[model samples]
Target: MTIDRSSMTALKVTLIGFAALASAMGVGRFAFTPLLPLMQAHAGLSLRQGAWLAGANYIGYLVGAMLCSMRVPATRHAVRYGLVAVALLTLGMGVTGRYDVWLVLRFGAGVASAYVLVGVSAWALPALAGHDRSVWSGWLFAGVGVGISLAGLLVLLAGARGYPPAASWLALGLASTAVAAIAWAPMRAAGASAAASAATQHAGRLSTDDWRLVLCYGTFGFGYIIPATFLPAMARDVIPDPAVFGWVWPVFGATAALSTVAVALGSSRMKSRRVWAIGQLVMAAGVLVPVLWPGIAALLVAAVCVGGTFVAMTVAGLQEARRIAGVNAARLMAAMTAAFALGQLAGPIVVALAATNGTRHAAGPSLLAVALLLAGAWALWRSPD
Candidate 1:
C-alpha cells in the first residue's frame, strides 16, 4: 500500500511519530526523573546508586543505538517490540524490590528507548521530507519534552495523593502502553528502507565538517544531561517539597516542547550548525545558573534554559549530520547518537566523582566544569577545522 501524502495522512503519521518518541523517550527513558526522589524517600536509594542506575541506562542506550545502526532489516518490527519492551520494563520497576532489578529495568528501558529513537528517526524524518513537511521535523523530537512533562506531572500527582513510588511507575507504564499502541501499526507498516539510513554514496570518509558536528554533539549531550538527570533532585535539596520541586520538570518539558516547535517553525534555510552553536551557548548558561544562584529560582531558570535548548540542539545536530553525510546520514546519525550516549554515560559518573562527602552541593564544582566544557564546544564549532 502506498502512502498518501496529499491528504491528512501525512500529518497523522507525523503526529504518530511524535507519539512513538513520546512513548520511547518520554515515558520509557525519562520516567526516572520524577521517580528519582520517590526512590530516595521510600527505597533508601542513595545518590550514588541512582547515578549508577542512570549510567546503566545510558550504556544500554549506546549499545542499542549501535545495534540499530547496523543496517538491520525490519526496523518496524524491532520498534514495535521495543515499544512493548519499554512498557513492560517500566511496569517491571513498580513490581521490583531489589536494586539489581531496578538497574536491569533501567538498562532495558534505555535499550528500548534507543531502538525507538533510531528507528523513528529513520522512518519519520524521511517521510516528512518526502511529503515536503520538513518544517514540522522538530515536532517529532518534541515528544521528549512532552514525555518529560507528563512523567513529571504523574509523579507530582502521585505525590499529592500520597501514592507510593511503585504506584507512580505502574500508572505511567499503563498510560505509555496505550500511547505506544497507537504508534505501533504505522511504524510497522514503514520498514527499515523508509528511514533512508543505508548509505547510497560511498565517498563516506569523514570530512572536517562531520568531525566538528560530532564533537559539538557530544558536548551538547554531556552538558544537557547533567541538569536533565539531576535538576529535580537539585530542586528537592533546596525546597524539599515535592509539590514545589516537581514543577521544575514540567516547566522544563513545557519549555522544551515549545522551543522544539519554535525551531521547527523557523525557516529551514537556517543552517543547522548555527542553531547547534547557539543552543550550546544557552545550555551553558542554564548549567551555570544553579552553580551561581543556588536556589529554587535559579534552578527553575536553569530548567527552562536547559530543557529548551537540548532538544533543539539535538534536532540541529542530526539534521546537520544528514546534510553533511548526504546519503550516508544513517552511519553519521549512529555515530552522533553513540557520541551523545557516551556523553550521557560520562555525566552521571562525573556527578558521582564530584559528590563532596557524598553530597549534592559538593558536586557544584563539577557542574561548573560541565558548563565550561560546553563553552569549549562552542569554540570547536567556530574553529576552522
Candidate 2:
C-alpha cells in the first residue's frame, strides 16, 4: 500500500524533531552534569557554586518557557530561531574558560534549549492524531536518551584521548549544529503546509483540567531532576572507580530510553496521570536505593529507575497537557514547562543542604519530595475529569 505525501512528510518531520530534541536536551542539559567535575577541577568552582550555576540554567529555562507562552510574533518564530540560538550557544560553551562566563553561557543555552523544546513540541504534536501522537511523543522524548548516550560516549572518548575540556564541548556543539541543519528543512516544510496551520491552531490554549495536569507534571519534574542531575557524582563518591563513573551515565541514558517505551506501552490502557505517578514512584524508589544500600549495585539500579521515569513522566505530562488543553495545548505546555523548570532549579539547592551533613542524607529529603509529589499526582488522577 502506498502512503500519501502528507504521511511521508509527517514521518520525516517526526524524525527531524527527534534529532532536534536529542541535541537540545542531551547536549544542552545532561552534558553539564557529567562535565561538572571537570569544570570544578579545571575551573576552581565549589560544589555549592557549581550547583547554583546548574540551577541558573533552569532559571533561564523557566524564563524562556514563560516568554514563549506569550502571543508574540517573535515567540511564534521560536521554532527556527530557538534552534539557531541553541546551536550557537552550544558552540559558545566550548570557548568560555571562566566560571562566571560559563554560568552566563549556560543560562543562555538553557533559554535556547527551553525554547527549542517547547516550540518543536508545539509544532510536532499536531502532525499526529489520537494514539499515534502519544506514541510519537514518547519516541521524541527517547531522543533525549539517545542524545545523552551520545554525549556520554563523547565525553568518555574525549577523556581517553586527553582532549581538552574546551574541545569536547566544541565537538558536542558541532554535532548539535549538524542535527539542527537536518531538522530545519523538514520543520520548515512541514510548517508551511495546511496541516501545519491546523496543528498550530490546535496547540494554542489550556483548560482547567490542564492546570491540574501541569501541577502534577511540575511536581514530577521537581522529583526526578534531583537524582538525574547528581546521580553520576553520587556514583563516583560511592564507587570512586573511573571505570564505574564511565559506565554510569551511559547506563542511565540507555535505561531511560527503554523506560520511555515502557511508559508509552503502559499508558496505552492507563490514564496519563496514573502512568506519570507510577513512573514517579519508581523514581522515588530508585533515589532511595543508594541511601538504603550505599553500594555500586544499588547505585546502578537507581540510575536505571530514575532514568526511565524521567522520560516517561515527560511524555505522559505533555500528552495529558495536550489532551486537557485541546487548542490551548501550547500555552498549557509552556506553563507546565515553566513549572517543571522551577522544580529543577530548586532541586539542587534543596539537595545541597543534604550535602552539608553528607551527600547521602540529601536522599531523605529528595525521596520525600518525590513521594509527596507523586502521591499528589495519583490523587489528581483519581479526581473528576
Per-candidate alpha-carbon RMSD to the true structure: 2.6, 3.3
> Once model 1 is optimally superposed onto the true structure by TM-score, how far is the C-alpha of residue 175 displaced, in angstroms?
1.7
What's the lDDT of the predicted structure labeled candidate 2?
A: 0.71
Reference-based TM-score of each model:
0.92, 0.89
| Residues 144-166, model 2: lDDT tens digits | 88888888777766665556668
Which residue ranges in model 1 land beyond 4 Å of their true spot?
A: 1-8, 192-203, 356-380, 383-385
- Which tens-of-lDDT digit does each residue in 1-385 have in candidate 1? 1334543355876787788788888888788977887788788888888888888899889888777655533457657888899999999988987999888999999988888777667556666776778778878888888988988998998876778899998987897788778767766556534533433433356677776666666777788778888888888888877889889999988888888889888746567677777788888888887876788999899999989988888787777776667667766777778778888888888777666533455356446546655664666567552
* Residue pairs whose backbone atoms clash in candidate 1: 122-195
For candidate 1, which ten residues in a row score worst on lDDT? 194-203
| Candidate number achieving the greatest TM-score relative to the actual structure | 1
